[model samples]
Target: MRYRLSIEDMEPNHWVVWVLDLPACFSSAQTPVDAVALAPGRISAYYSWLSSHDSSLPVITESIEVEIVETFHSFASTQDQEYLVNAFFEDDRRPPNYWDVELALRLLQWTRQDLLKVVQSATQEQLSRPMVCEVRGSIAGIIKHIAGAENWYFDQLDLALDRAQLPDDPLDMLKAVRTNTRAQLVKLMGNERITKNCDELWSARKVIRRTLWHERDHTQHIAHLLAHL
Candidate 1:
């Protein structure tokens, strides 16, 4: 399998290589060279992840190839911005079918499970301990950020989740916001409506892409925090 890469240079040490073929899958490293070098491995892992979650996916192949086809420079974080240079793959414009949203929902379920599992074992001390390396400062902060981002994604299309109703506990808030995410996303299953909020564009495909990336990215972030704590 050969996956085309779109590299985003978000500041000096933060480089993200987006696998355009697989919407939600990406690799991050300190430099463009290392980030591109990491793409093939991430592509393989992505396939393994999908196959593990849904047996309907094709059998994994041993060979994986990736080429960097596009690159963009940005100072802002990809999580903060709704758009990336390669954010809208040519593939994304196509109207999604039932199976597209179904598979995405399944992946969502698995990624959230992966996240909760990582955080579930953490002691209260580990959750609250501040870290200089993390922008969100601590595991607990990251959890809230995850839920908040999920809501913000929906609001990009003017489909807002009620903030007043969210729980105070980070984990519970994550659960509540995800329930809202699932409902909104299900409505987008066969609908191809696209809307723009500010300078950014929103579509069902883009929403799914960013939502998956944010949650999965933070899941790894929390795992990293747990490793060093």
Candidate 2:
């Protein structure tokens, strides 16, 4: 199968290739070629992961093929402005059925668990040790980013949370945001709503997509960070 891809190239060598057919399935790398190179493996892994909870997708083969169907680039960081994929794809508007939502919820739950496990035994000093980089500051910053971005994805759909009173403990904050975000995600099952804020576009599917992607992205990030310590 030739999978369709959506590439988001942002400032400073950030390249993310999104598999439009698979919600929340994305691969990132420092260059476009490397990013695209990683997509086949991500596609294979996603099928195995999806099949764990729902055995509907066909058994994936070893050989995976992909083509760049959509491309968006920004010279500045995506975090600094309206992000990529301004308009929803044809598949984006299709309201998720009960099965879709349930599968997504399962994926989210597992992804979060993986993230927590990576940082389970890190010392406070290790968590807060400053490291100069982009939005990713330190281990603690990654945790905060994971939590904050989860809540913000909900905000895109007008499914707002009381961000002002969020918990400060990194783990507590992660749990709280995910709990609320899951509630919001549940409401999105069969929802046919899509909203535009500024020039950015979002839908129930989009929110789920971005939320899962961010969680998985940072989980691997934290795991790599932990490997060095």
Task: TM-score each candidate.
Answer: 0.84, 0.84
Clashing pairs for model 2 are: none
The residue pairs that clash in candidate 1, if any, are none
Q: Output the lDDT of residue 3, model 2.
A: 91
| Model 2 quality (TM-score) | 0.84
Model-by-model lDDT, in order? 0.80, 0.80
Residues 1-229 of candidate 1: C-alpha lDDT, one tens digit per residue: 6778877775558888888778679999999999889888888888888888778987667688888787766533355565433345445556667887887788899999899889988998899888898898889999999999888888877776788878988999998889888887778877677765544456878778779999999898889879877
Query: In candidate 2, what are the lDDT values of residues 104-201, reduced to their tens digit?
Result: 88888778777777788788898988877636678998998899988987898878678899988888999899888778777888889888765566
Q: What is the Å distance of residue 136 in model 1 from its true position?
A: 1.7
